[model samples]
Target: MKAFWTLSASGELWQHLAISSWRALVGFAIGGSIGLILGLISGLSRWGERLLDTSIQMLRNVPHLALIPLVILWFGIDETAKIFLVSLGTLFPIYINTWHGDTQY
Candidate 1:
């Protein structure tokens, strides 16, 4: 529709996208840092892997969309909850990929 196209091209749309992109970038960084630390710890200590591997795998399979209601219930509709979800979403992918990539053949 013309109205949808006009709205999509508006300055407000770009601003909203930029804000969302920035949050994604921040989430990526936070998650990547956590993943990297976990990777290093796993590499450096078998005990760390023993402690963390199962829980990370369990968390990986959780449906993120389904978490919104619970996250909002637990954390409320605030910046902290939004960022927490973003961080969790970002963290899982990196951790799963790293674990898969680095594991033995």
Candidate 2:
């Protein structure tokens, strides 16, 4: 497309792409770190599982879209909010997988 080519040639597209990549990477790191930590804790220890698994499972059941309004209210439509949403979106899956992997071994 001519428009796409124009934007790419101007560097605007790359800039936006880089920003998006950064956000995704940062969010994934934060979410993955927390998820892995919590998963390990829960998977390895009875007390940790008792304390966190039920709450995490319950929270996981709620839809991400349903939390958008609340997230906007809490975070106020900023980069932080965007990253938080991404991290929150990523957390449960990473946690569930990590926990399962840890427990299965």
Candidate 3:
């Protein structure tokens, strides 16, 4: 307990937290932007729905973890891999919710 509290007060812990928070924010922003754009396109226009909706739905059904091996192979063990993984994981929920919101009204 003492060690943990000391570490939490240390600069290293703060730095690690800052880096993680930044990564999460960036990943979410990228995922949300893509999802919002796609949802808007599909929900607002007939042509866009025809062109993008089926594909989006299909991709949404895919488990994000299933892509981990490919992502690791392609991106290696880098920060980009972490961000990309997070973005991919977040994309489907945002996309689905945005699509539902846009279409419901």
Candidate 4:
């Protein structure tokens, strides 16, 4: 607790917090945009739903942790990978919820 106070007083805590918050914000924006677009398509069009629903459902079933290695391999251990992983984690919930809300009669 004392160490936390020390870091906070020195602004290190704020810096780290800001970075994390920024990452989450960026990830959420990216994920939410894609989710919204896809959800609208799936909800509105029977052909679009047939095209996208299966793939999105499969993605929703896969755990984010299980994709860490693949994300790393594909994007390398950089900010991009971190953002992508965060986006992946954020994507499905928004997608699922939007789909449900938009599609259900």
Candidate 5:
């Protein structure tokens, strides 16, 4: 499994991790914003909640990780693809947390 990816630069592991972290941070910001907007809507408005709540729940329930292959195919194993996947992973948690917080208020 590990052999699939090549770590070409022997001492570039730190740099690689840094790049991955930067991508994840970018993804987090984008995904978190979308999630917050969604969570706020779901928590604050009945119409908005009804419109998104089900779909969000449904999609979130699906193994988001399952989309990686499609993502890689669509975006090609680039920074965009990595960020997109990370963003997708970040979305639900932020949405869920915000929704919970909103409801608790």
Candidate 6:
């Protein structure tokens, strides 16, 4: 408990926290925007849905863990890789929810 408290009180903790928060927010924004746009298109146009829905659903089902090696190879173990993984994690749920919401009404 003492060590944990000491670590929490340190400047390094805050810096790490801020970086994590920034990554999360930026990733969410990118993923959410793309999901929303694609969802809207899919919901509004039958052709768009036919073209994209299957591909997206198929990609969504592929496990994130399975892609980590590829992501690392492509982006390396850097901030970009972290953010890309975060965004990819967020994209499917946002897309499915937005598509359902747009289409149900």
Which candidate's TM-score is highest? 2
**TM-score list, all predictions:** 0.76, 0.94, 0.89, 0.91, 0.82, 0.93
TM-score of model number 5: 0.82
Query: Which of 1 and 5 is ahead in TM-score?
Result: 5
Which digits, one per residue and each the tens of the lDDT, describe model 2 over residues 1-105?
997999899989998889999999999999988999999999998899999999999999999999999999999999999999889988998999989998897
Write down the lDDT of every candidate, Cα atoms only. Answer: 0.77, 0.93, 0.86, 0.87, 0.87, 0.91
User: How many clashes show up per model?
Assistant: 0, 0, 0, 0, 0, 0
For this target, which candidate reaches the highest lDDT against the unseen true structure?
2
Model 3, poorest ten-residue lDDT window? 3-12
What's the residue-level lDDT of 85 in candidate 1? 84
Per-candidate RMSD vs. true structure? 2.5, 1.1, 1.6, 1.2, 3.9, 1.2
lDDT of 3 by residue, 20-64 (tens): 999999999998889888888888888998999999888888887
Write candidate 1's Cα lDDT for 9-75 as tens digits. 7857777778788878887788888987776565456787898888887878889998899999999
Number of clashing pairs, model 4?
0
Tens-digit lDDT track of model 6 for 4-65: 67868785678778999999999999988888888888988889899999999999999999
Query: On TM-score, who's better, 2 or 6?
Result: 2
lDDT of 4 at 67: 89
In candidate 3, stretches whose alpha carbon ends up further than 4 angstroms from where it belongs are 1-3
- Model 1 clash pairs? none
Q: How many pairs of residues collide in model 5?
A: 0
lDDT measured at residue 12 in model 3 versus the true structure, 0 to 100: 71
Q: What is the C-alpha lDDT profile of model 4 across 1-105, one tens digit per residue?
A: 998999999989989999999999998899888888888888888898899999999988888889889998999998899989778777777877877888787
If ranked by TM-score, best first, what sequence of candidates would result? 2, 6, 4, 3, 5, 1
